[model samples]
Target: MFLYTENFEGQKEMAMAGLSRALAEDRVDRDIIPLLEKINALDNYFTTSSCSGRISVMEMPHFGDKLNSVWLGKWHREVFIEEVFEAIGRHRSGQLWFLVRSPILHVAARTMDDAVKLLNLSIGLGFKYSSIKSVSHRKLLVEIRSTERMDVPLGEDGELWVSEEYIGRIVNLANAQVRRFKGKLKRLEDEIEVLEK
Candidate 1:
């Protein structure tokens, strides 16, 4: 049985509840305890963060062959999102580098709406102007400068490469959202104080 919260606060509360429930349900299932512990710890990281970084991270395969469309399955998306959530729950700073299949950039940046929509999504996901970068161009490969944990590299034969750098950026992007949210909280606090006086 898995229960997640609607957001960070709920995550924290549910994690605590999960811990109690797990402890009672299986005194011998020690493994469940550790999982609950980890989830509980994530509360601090998640609560401190203001917005969610729902990244549209993608990658291309077979740039040298006939493959043109970026292939991302439903299960792949879920795992990616879960991995990102955990990564963000781990760190306080970093960039969210979206490793798309080298050609999504052309598709994403083809129109004004596309670029605007991307930026809007980034803002909604807690971007700090400087924390977003995209790596593309299969034929014109540029060396990526990152100390990430997850990297998915696609070869000429179309083998997806996953690395740490990609994973690390989730934390970075989430930290950015936290900072943005904190600012909003401060403003609200100040306004409330003024009204009280």
Candidate 2:
């Protein structure tokens, strides 16, 4: 048997409550809900946060300025080139960027052994960036994440730098990435029950 962190049950309960609230508010990603439910059903784990990956066009005051960033368009599934153009049309005064991010899940494990088991499983499922994020008597956190991503600068200050052809090419690439990660998520969801053994 594994030794769990102090107040692990209490923490799991609180996390579940938070997840319920997020669901009620439509803040949780739809594609990731089934996977999250499977993980949460286990005795040793509960998810704290997650994203089912996304393709987005964003505007920011400057590079790496997340606080001032505004999303012109965001999609959890694959997108069309025309949709991309529409988002670009909304861009005003800021640095515009096109981005694709892979799926990420932050899980709180009941113990270090559980954490490592989940981390290894996630890495094997193509979440190459999976790792133990933090360890303490209060919590053991694991980050399950993939490496597929793209950050392309589109323009600045209401200026368009890339052509429509260029945007089309990047849109194709982003869609491919979206398909790839969705496959991985499916595999992980199918295999998650193995952790119980």
Task: Identify the runs in model 1 with alpha carbons over 4 angstroms from their true place.
Answer: 1-162
Give the Cα lDDT of each candidate: 0.31, 0.94
Per-residue lDDT over 72-126 for candidate 2, one digit per residue giving the tens place of the 0 to 100 score: 9999999999999999999999899999999989999988889989998999989
TM-score of every model versus the real structure: 0.21, 0.97
Error of 2 at 90 (Å): 0.6
Clashes of each: 22, 0
Clashing residue pairs found in predicted model 2: none
> Residue-wise lDDT of candidate 1 within 24-135, one digit each (tens)?
8753234223322332343222111111112333323332322543323211122345654443333222222233211011111222332344344333433324121322
